[model samples]
Target: MKILVCIKQVPDMESRFRPNGEKTWYDESDLAFRMNEYDEYAVEQAVQLKEQLGGEPEITVLSIGPERTVEAIKKALAMGGDRAVHIRDDRYYQKDPWQIASMIASYAKGEGFDLIFTGMQSQDRGSAQVGVIVAELLGVSCATTLVGFSYDGGTITVKRELEGGIKGVAKLKLPALVTCQLGLNTPRYPTLPNIMKAKKKEIASLTAAELTGEAELTATAAIYPPAKKGGGLVLEGEIGAQVDRLMGILKEKTAVLR
Candidate 1:
């Protein structure tokens, strides 16, 4: 069996972010980069599937970004991916969902991968379209936001998370795609030996132009943080007084009471 896991390098959420000169995305110069948090669950699920199948599958971790993405790929390798492919794109942040998905689908086409795994969405962009778009472009079945997964070498069964704490079950044959969600599995920390071994693993590099000629379907006019709002009003006194004050404020400030 063959499995392809797609991942991305994103700025650590804790780091301070500033808009770039173009104001299209966050500046990368002073930011610390790490693998997208959601992709870690995808990688863990892939590794667990390999173990469940007696370690016969070839797991290839793929990422599209600038050279800094090599670090994220290495981390996936340490977590049990056999090899990696890096699709280099210096202006990756500028690409819209269509362009990004096109590049991934272009490379994945005819690759004979039995399964493809990706995160439900990226942390930075949070546009949860790439995996499903890749599946559509490849003409395969797809399921998103998977919380549970099982495979029997011929078909895969997954439990998808729906709104309102509901789960929808789905089954897909070979050559399918799935986008993993959080709590699907516990990600393991890479040990020292595995980290060392990952440094020697093979990583094939390619350029975005080499993969696809798709043009951007959307453009960002601007990006900025939300405007600050005033502090909340505190109600002080007994329960009845607090309720009366709340009702008075609502009637005065909003149309809800009317």
Candidate 2:
């Protein structure tokens, strides 16, 4: 089986964020980068599937980002991916979901991959559209936000998380795509040996233009932090006095109270 896992490099969620000068996106300087947390589950699931299938599967991890993205790809390889493909694009933040999916679909068109795995959403964008768009472009069956997965060589059965804590079951034949959700599986930490081995693995690099000529369909208007709110007011005194003061303040400030 040929399986492809898509991943992304995102700023560590714990890191402090600041807007860039242009205010189009967050500033990258001084921010630590890591693999999107959701993608870690996707990678782990792919490795587990490969083991279940007796390691016959050829797992390829792919990421689209600036040169620094290679670190994310290497991590996936260390976790058991056979090889990787890096779609170099320094201006990746400017590309919309359609353009991103187009590049992936274009490269995977004739690759004869039987399955594709991706995180339910990226940490940075959180759009959750790229995987489905890629499936649509490739004309393959797709299931998103999968919490459970099972395969019998030809067909895959997955349990998807829906709104309101509900779960939906889906079955898809070969040549399908699925976006993995958190708790689908626990990701394994790459051991020292595996990390060393990953350093020697091949990572094929390609420019985004080489894969697709699709133009951007959307543009960022602006990105900035939320406005700060006024400090909270504390009412002190007896319960009766506090209630009276609170009512007075509410009536003065809000028409609904009046």
Q: TM-score for all predictions?
A: 0.89, 0.88
> Model 2, residue 175: what's the lDDT?
94
| Residues 1-258 of candidate 1: C-alpha lDDT, one tens digit per residue | 989999999999998888899899998898999999999999999999999989999999999999999999999999999999999999988899999999998898978888999999999899999999999999989999999999985999999999999999988998899999999999999999999999999999999989888888899999888776876987888999999999999999999896
In candidate 1, position 28 carries an lDDT of 85
Off by over 4 Å in 1: 233-258
lDDT of 1 at 168: 98
Prediction 2 global C-alpha lDDT: 0.94
Overlapping backbone residue pairs in candidate 2 total: 0
Candidate 2 clashing pairs, residues 3+ apart or interchain: none
lDDT of 2 by residue, 83-134 (tens): 9999999988889999999999998999988999999999988999999999
